[model samples]
Target: MNMDNRRYNVNARSLPVSNALHGSSTVISELEPLHRRSDVVLNEQGLPRHSGCTRLKKLVHKSKIRFGTWNVGTLNCKSVEVVGVMIQRKINILCLQETKWRGEEAKDIQGFKLWYTGKVSARNGVGIIIDKEWKRNVVEVSRIGDRIIFLKMIIGRETVNIVSAYAPQVGIEASLKELFWEDLEGLIRHIPQNEKIFIGGDFNGHVGREAGQYARVHGGFGFGELNNEGQTLVDFSLAYDFKIANTCFKKRDEHLITYKSGASRSQIDFLLVRNTDRRLCKNCKVIPGDAVTTQHRVLVLDVCIMSKIQKRRQVVTPRIRWWQLKGEKQDIFKRNLLDKGIWESQGSANIIWEDMAKKIWEVAKVVLGESKGLVREIRSLGGGIIVYRTKSSIRRTVLKPYICVTMRKIGRGTVWLRKKLRELWVKLVLKLLKNFIRTLRRRKESKIFIRLPRVGKENQEI
Candidate 1:
């Protein structure tokens, strides 16, 4: 009776007061669950309605090409074996030094092709090996003696020059060393500025651990202390605006050192590219234990070519054949322009010029018509050879060895002529000998001075 009397007295004072008190308790109960929960939620109906922060996804299209260099000591018998290592590492182009393979020749081994140049004696030589995928793209191969060799190839609308160089040792003659550098510089100078150049070889120098004064070319992360040869290399890089690719990335002593023998270890080999193309080089490091040779380790460089995806639609504007506007077509075009009142247009000079141009284009389109475009057909001569026919003459580009001896013997007219003459002389001699033998066979006792072997048991007289 006492509790019921107190509740009835509180409610009798104000009905609204009791209702407000009940609503506050309900709100507290709802908030208590929200405070205990770990998940966060936004208001369903609000001014923003969504988050202010946004997530972005990036779309990047890039093609990667791997370049490597090694001093194989001698590549005569190990051609197939070294190619195996290249395939395993997925190297597209490789530079070899001290190949000791005499004569300039292009040999194919296990799908990989090697273009090498050396002297008569098997001593120092340089060569470039391209993978099967890129072998067909080679357009030109230039051999600068036995020390330097380079090739030009087309890779995705870009022209790339790959050079393989072998510098002389420290103990070599000073004059010869200078000559080598001079030849290298000359080679680089002749290449067009638009093309990409990658020089990978055993430079036989140490750029030091710090860039110091050579910071422009050296990347501050190098091996060993700087020497005279290293300074020469740094000077060359400065002159040509090149970056020592191997020194650009930070690496441990093991990966930084390229040549190791006994307790001696140093980074003598290097890969270089133009300063403008430095961004294309993603990584450069030495691969240990996978050595095809003993002293020098394999240096691999990762080059990335970023091709932007074009999103805009290409608008091919129709080109009117203005040359066709003659005789009746020319009169028709003039009449249409006059009928359009292009010359009588009134306003500013810009307005009159725009009207005139529009009228002329419209008249020309109706009178002359658009061109169908030029037709060009490219023919392949098989074996990496192509014949390009132009308005003047047909140009032949040889990328690899052709099956035909005459085609392969191009550029050596004297040698080819001599070979043909010798072949003809041999055929004539063989024909005369065949006739003499036939005469001897016809006469049973004609060969009394010399006895010929019996052709068969049925005709044993000869």
Candidate 2:
């Protein structure tokens, strides 16, 4: 058997291979090094060879602010728990629906502050919870009934208006749904175009997975099928030029579904922003595992503000002890003014008022020094009134003098005169009793006997 010789004589045959395969192999080889490297290598122009199709690089230095929306069913005893979750998630601002907390007020839980609005009955409420850092930046909070609330805050140079809306459920009355839409539209219309608007809430409508006619507003990444209620939401987005952030990014089914109960799951809750500012959103998804509620999941949106926030510097301007002018410092100040020849100066008539004012201020500074701290001394002829030097302090001083004058006028009336007469009568009766007791004790010391006056049985003679 010569099988070894036959195998050596066999020639290899060439087969047709596609150029695409060859090119892909070369591309994969080139990308192998990049995949192994932890950092991307910049090209000659100082940009990655294959930069992603995103403008996020421009905001590399900016910080991401996480905003979330959740339908908690009822905050009742879970407010602290909700805040705890928010802190863990690092969400800066959170829009809440179905708060079930009555009244319109802000409550501080841990480091978060919740501004909620509701009616007398504990149902269908909305609120916005902001972290401690952003609490001071809040300029206004507008509560519209129990279903809608608007929070305006300054972030860097931009004015951000966050609207928390709870739309009527799918089976709710038609009139109520229309009213909600109308109110929402009016709110958006009133917001200045230059400001950033973020409307986050439980919209209670599924936008579906298909954009169809709503390609501009719906991002085609939603869950479930579109219904009448969903159509309304899409139309609203189209009218307001808002991009439904929930459907903007592709994600797994679990991450796209916001509401799950029993055997049903859908994407009713949504986060929306102006279409023009869509690029500012880095990511938006439903956190399925971090469940604050039984049915609804937290839908979070990461927004990167491109503007750099400049820290405000507090200028502590020295305040003159003007109250001292009412005391001995008055004479000293006048003498110093005269000594400085500020008013006696025969300067040119063309001298500006600023220069003359400056000269007077200089003389006053030397005579009555600036206040040392918050404490200010207000001297009267009788005594000194020490109070904190603040606007409220001035208000109190003004009101106190007016109140004293009012009391003086009132004291001259008949009622106050009767009160004074009653007081004087009590004092006279007590003084007479004391004098009589003293006389009796002196007489007893001299062993003198005195006959007491007879009186009625009820008032026995002493």
Candidate 3:
């Protein structure tokens, strides 16, 4: 085999005097077919594993942040369950309206922290709930009456400002509506231009389906016709160059509607962000099967997070299988160290320790083998559907748009095939879920038994 031999050079000036104590004279050359570093990593089962910094860069450059907005009518007794719903949806930040939480201070609900603003009674109120992971980054909190509350957080290298608001109803006095807008205007003006901001709440308006001249703010995807309240929101968005996140994505009417009761359906709850950051949004749809039990459906916004400072992610070093070093391998390791001329060098105690450590690692790696990479299992669910499950990245369904279009063109045959494929996918997901639950239960039971003995004998049950 044609081989490419490589060698790493060590600095001579840094060498110490103690290296003469323990020594070797072997010259190590990495050969392509022998001891060369392979770009393709393999696991114990001989399967290929993903290596390098590509995955790490993807993880650090863009993070998925989910924002949910819902008008719970009142957060009086359902704070715990509502937080649970947020957790279930994997929401990082939640903005609530009509909370009826009569307080101007922040309160802890379960593990999340809630910052709310309201008057004396349970009337109009707005609140912002931050996930426990990001709560420590909070730098400032602003509570402005019962209609608006703003929070600023230092996330990574960027500053994020979140505002929760509850606008006056459609039939409310014109003066109150005007006052609401005026207050919101002041709040917007006070925010720094360099910081990222997101405002979410029950706006009680619809931007309509026609973009017309408002295409800068609305993406021509909306439910219901435009009303006076909606016109006000659109005008504000146009003036500030902010995009309505819900209107930016094209989804079915079911996903667009945020409030539904009997025959009445409307898109009122909204999430707004700067137009420049609109491209970072992946999906903004209403959660249909929300268990919050409220008139307003939960509007979830999936936005790709960006950090101003680029930090290098730490790579995990594989563990060396030292147990495999026996017989000929152990002799080879000793001989290679002796050949490296480690003892012949003149070095101090610290330098000797460093040289010996390096020589041992290199000799062992060459004598034995480099650590094996992780092997990931690929699952196939009949009908050409495949899924690659791994801890390095989220499990994504493998689908090609071109293939789907081609399948649809084959008439009824394609339709039948698609139906069968969907059925198989569902079944596979359910099976995986069952197995995951079983594993979790086993772990929980094991923990219980382990702690049971630690407790007093009188307190422990059989």
Among the numbered candidates, top TM-score falls to: 2
| Candidate 2 clashes between residue pairs 3 or more apart in a chain or in different chains | none
Please give, for residues 1-462, the per-residue lDDT of candidate 2 as tens digits: 353343333222112333432333223244454334322222223322232311112322465799999999999889988988888888999999999888999988997889999995567999999998998999998998889999999887788999999999978999999999999998899998889999999888878897888889988888999888988998999998999998989999999998999999898999999998899999999887765688999999999977763533434346676756767778887877677666654557756455667777887788767644432222121111212123212211111232222222222437767467545533443354455546545655322221111111211122
| Model 1 Cα lDDT, one tens digit per residue, 23-90 | 43223334555334322122223222123311122234576999999999898778888998998888
Candidate 3, lDDT over the whole model: 0.71
Expressed as tens digits, the lDDT of each residue in 1-462 for candidate 3 is: 222222222111112333421322112323433233333211223221322111111224556789888898888888998889988889989999888877788889887999988995558898999888878889999988899999998777777899998999989999999999899989999888888889998888877877878989998898899999999999998888899999888899999999999899999999999998888789999988876764788899998878654544434345455766779878887788899976865679888889888888877777776554322222211112322223222122433333333332223346676567555544543454455446545654321111111112212211
In order, the Cα lDDT scores of the candidates are 0.74, 0.72, 0.71
> Model 3 segments beyond 4 Å from truth?
1-60, 308-462
RMSD of 2: 29.9
* Model 1 misplaced stretches (Cα beyond 4 Å): 1-61, 308-462
Q: Relative to the unseen true structure, what is the C-alpha lDDT of residue 153 in candidate 3, on a scale of 0 to 100?
A: 87
> Could you tell me every candidate's TM-score relative to the true structure?
0.57, 0.58, 0.56
Predicted candidate 1, C-alpha RMSD:
31.4
Name the lDDT of candidate 2. 0.72
In angstroms, how far off is 11's CA in candidate 1?
59
